[model samples]
Target: DERLGLVQMAIDEHTWLASEAREGETVELLVKSHPHLSIVHFTLNGADDVLRYRKWCWSGPMFRMITMGRCGDTEAVVARACRDGADLDAGHFIMGPQMPDISSSAARSALAREDIAAAALLLHPEVLLWCREHKVWQASTEPLRRDERLKHTNRPSGTPQQPC
Candidate 1:
């Protein structure tokens, strides 16, 4: 019951924070709850990490929002967070496939008929990959960047290439 209470409280507070734009205060609250805040930017960046954390209740919506470009600071936060071992747990987070929020019964029922392609169209590459890996969507490989070019020359293992 106590655990349930905390979950409820956290959900309530999270909703309030997002709706109210009380970003600073919400971030402070997160920092206070987790010790990693000391060495980490626990506000926005950690929020992405949180999205990538399966243990967190906000993962699904948050990940979806971030991937959909619906969140305010998701890009900046995620970029900054990567400098500090974000990838270390990134795979773990995606592998588990967190459950979507279903507290709103209507939404839960609606999801029964939801289309995976539509959902995938709204997600980031990482989230798209996660969804595909989990069988929520059929995987389609993203095209390589046109500017992403490489150059090489034929050479033997024991010799460097001569001038062309």
Candidate 2:
């Protein structure tokens, strides 16, 4: 919970920086603050306009963020990608079967990793479809949905807002 709070603060700081400056320093600060989060690296360098940003996200660590289920960050990236008219299906394909050097089993394992349940909530339709086709969807995501619901209902009203 503390880590999530720190991440929310970083997201807030990132938002402020994006409005105040155009340099990479904001992203750098985020990375320095939350180096363990793949989302931080993706957010820093993937702030360009939609097409360029999507291209960068696909090419850089942002793709991992997507798979890792950093929901707020992934949502922001996806929103930008959609705005730029980038095809979500292509991105899904790349992150799924087309990812370099990983076998299907490995990719499936990656998808079913600890954070994957959250990842499923934000995944593109194509990726979700792929998971369903591969029989990995319901088993992995259902329990997470239940847990998320409980967490949401139990959280206090004063909790800091995430940057989704």
Provide TM-scores for the models. Answer: 0.18, 0.20
Clashing pairs in 2: none
Model number with the top TM-score: 2
Q: Return the lDDT, model 1, position 38.
A: 53
Residue-pair clashes, model 2: 0
The models' CA-based lDDT, in order, is 0.33, 0.39
lDDT of 2 by residue, 19-95 (tens): 21332346677777988985333322222222333453344324322332232344555566567565556543122
User: Which stretches of candidate 1 lie above 4 Å from their native place?
Assistant: 1-70, 88-90, 93-164
Error of 1 at 17 (Å): 22
Q: List the residue pairs that clash in candidate 1.
A: none
- Give per-residue lDDT, candidate 2, residue 87: 58
